[model samples]
Target: MLPLAGERKNAKGIIFEKAYSRNISRGTSTLKRGFAHMLKNGVVMDVTTVEQAQIAEDAGAVSVMVLDKLPSDVRKAGGVARTASIRIIQEIMDSVTIPVMAKCRIGHVYEARVLQETDVDMIDESEVLTPADEHHHIWKWDFTTPVVNGARSLAEALRRIEEGAAMIRTKGEPGTGNVAEAVTHIKKVNDELRAIKAIYDSGDNQDLIRMAREFKVSYDIVEQTARLGRLPVVNFAAGGIATPADAAYLMSLGCDGIFVGSGIFNANDAKERARAIVLATTFWNEPEKVKEAQKMIDERQSMLGLDVNTLELRMQERGGSA
Candidate 1:
């Protein structure tokens, strides 16, 4: 069973220690993968307050992402978007039973440590926040808590996984309420994976070796990914998903799940929209069901979306050379 919030200890008496102290082995990696596995085919909503967390829980969200501001607000109020206050995170934890994930800026290991200490189910090395270090992302292999990082291409995704990110999400132009960028990103990853699989089927190890070198990841990771024809870790679509159709569209495009940031609370019907997004994500294959979900809220009430081109600060561009 997955560990519960604040349950810090297992029967083995393992105390959550500094992430760097944990031994690097297959067992540890599997632990992170397993946690992400549980959240497959679900929607993770971004929330700011305990009330919002409760609403998300009631709306049937599989998990809630705790942050100080919604992505849209983050874009409006330009500054460092750090982790949410621990006190608020704890209160939200108390308000809901589902897994709670908190964001830490890229390369901010100390912030990640604080989140791990708070016993959040997971940490997001989010590009949506202002990056603390542009040259490097946190060495996630050092942490016990699993991390979900963003990527725009297969190479970026593979590199993050090699660095011990248990899950990956497309770093779509966040806070913009535009799904175009997210669609482009997921398509980019899928196309690259297909290309790699073709090379693998041709019995070309040299190409795989070259790709491994180019991605700065081990050959084993490249080989495994080619063999699987997809990311070894769970993959989710995130950024500016504003509607149920957007959620289902991503699911149809081979994403394991969707992450909604400004879509929910900023809308006029937070409760109805949240519930509809969950339903749409879970029943993505059925067009009728998705239509029903789409009708749950009025488009006029949707958050005023910003054009990706007009944005001065593009959060998705933060991570690396993707």
Candidate 2:
């Protein structure tokens, strides 16, 4: 069963009123696909296991990311799942048809191959909490199954898409335990894209390339990413997403969706947090709601180290293994 609306203590030591989203519809926008219709009114919920995944689906997440294992725990435990157990993977898939995504270590094609046999909808060459076989970019063309890889910058995002990734992400690192890094990265990419567009529209073609490069998009994807203001998925702003405002903020950035990792399950008020975050996406443009939701997050939210450079290096180090 999914996580029910459980009672919990709050500032006044009173049980907080709780509710969960039942889907997103008639929201600020509908989730879009490609450059246009990627699950616009979508949101992602990350779960450590199958039980929580079912809960997320029940609570209205458009999709659920089920980790093979959690990095937060693995940082304490010594090892990682070379591959998520087939039984556990199948359990989650069985529980929900709303796009169950399973993560595997980078370059661990065997794990992905196995997940494919189970009929998963997509593969997230994830580098978050329990990353394995990390790679600079997942080989999208190599897999028959569609992939969603992390992009710290637009260049990486576009390159992955160009390489055949069905979806591209902002690479909001997993288990950073803080939202600031994700926020900063998201802002940088968006700001850079905006600047590039401004310069391009100004007819400064010579400098536009250099400027777009700053945001991380390659020459080809600049045309594509710039064609649309938002990303291609159900763009799920992940990582330190912990509260309703956090989810709302991503929506404000034109994100199609928000992906909550441990944030939902770890919140002091899990059900309320989930409900609020779920509702926030729908009411994203509302100033009063954003004000009310902002208070839920702590001012000191921070993220740990996850230099994509280092991850790229790690991915490169395994070149011979592949």
Candidate 3:
């Protein structure tokens, strides 16, 4: 538990335990509030520019994920921060009333705290790109604000959820400009969860959580939802989301929402792509309406191009058994 370096200290003569207890007891359930809003319409937009964010909002995205710059720093230099300036996030928030999310480099709760001050709706502790905080993952439960983490597999997703992430996504392999990887990963996790529900009743939520903790699950989150209790927020697919059709496919497999990062920006038709995703989520499961989303992206999102191969391998190594 590496405490933030500058956390304000108690007064010199303050009665330590009593004062701390009173304030902490009154602590706000910010995470729950955040989760509710992010899941309101079961769709979220991940965008690299303010213009893209406006497009997403206009198309009815439940939330807008803002970034500073994209693709260039990511493809050539591993990954970099999407929100180049706080002003970019502010501008997007100003442009729309829906929830707005900003990413914080992993293990940097202090930065997350700063974003919280900005009054943004949520903070995604996503490894969309390589993190600035080196190897340390952010401790989700420790923050006063709700923080989301990405998982490549069910176990990993549960691990973060156990650590108190308000929401989780399929780990986005940045700069891939695709969605196939996310599609397959999400499908497998959803299937695994449904199977668990088949084997054990939903009444045993506590039992599933215990198993998750004992086994140290680390990847997919849908596994936990089927095992544990229904989550307060929708489980969504993130990463490699290249088109609206891909978004619809994920929703069909039981995802409540979808997160688009590079997928929306790289299409050469950012506005149309964003609209495709919003509409796909809007009528995702209706067969007749679904066909209209077919060409959101004709190409598949390939995992082979990702820099986070080790992260991918970590989940593949211990593939779950249904």
- In TM-score terms, which candidate is top? 1
All candidates in order of lDDT, best leading: 1, 3, 2
Candidate 2 Cα errors over 4 Å, as ranges: 1-38, 129-136, 208-218, 227-234, 288-322
Which digits, one per residue and each the tens of the lDDT, describe model 1 over residues 38-92? 8999999999999999999999999999999999998888877888999999999
Could you give the candidate ranking by TM-score, starting with the highest?
A: 1, 3, 2
| Per-residue lDDT of model 3, residues 1-322, tens digit only | 1211112223121122456446433113333434544474466766666778778888777887776655323555543443446877888878887788888766666677778789777787756444556545666555555667776665665556655666767764555655666777776666656655653574565665565565475323434356453443446787666666777777777776887766666656666567767777788877566566655534443223454453332222121221
What lDDT would each prediction earn against the true structure?
0.87, 0.58, 0.60
Per-model TM against the reference = 0.91, 0.72, 0.72
**Positional deviation of residue 176's Cα in model 2 after best superposition, in angstroms:** 3.6
Q: Least lDDT summed over 10 consecutive residues: which range in candidate 2? A: 2-11
Q: Write the per-residue lDDT of candidate 2 for residues 156-192, one digit (tens) a residue.
A: 5555555555565565655544556567667866875
Once fitted onto the true fold, the runs of candidate 3 whose alpha carbons sit more than 4 angstroms away are 1-34, 37-41, 71-73, 79-83, 132-135, 195-199, 202-210, 217-232, 295-322
lDDT of 1 at 302: 89
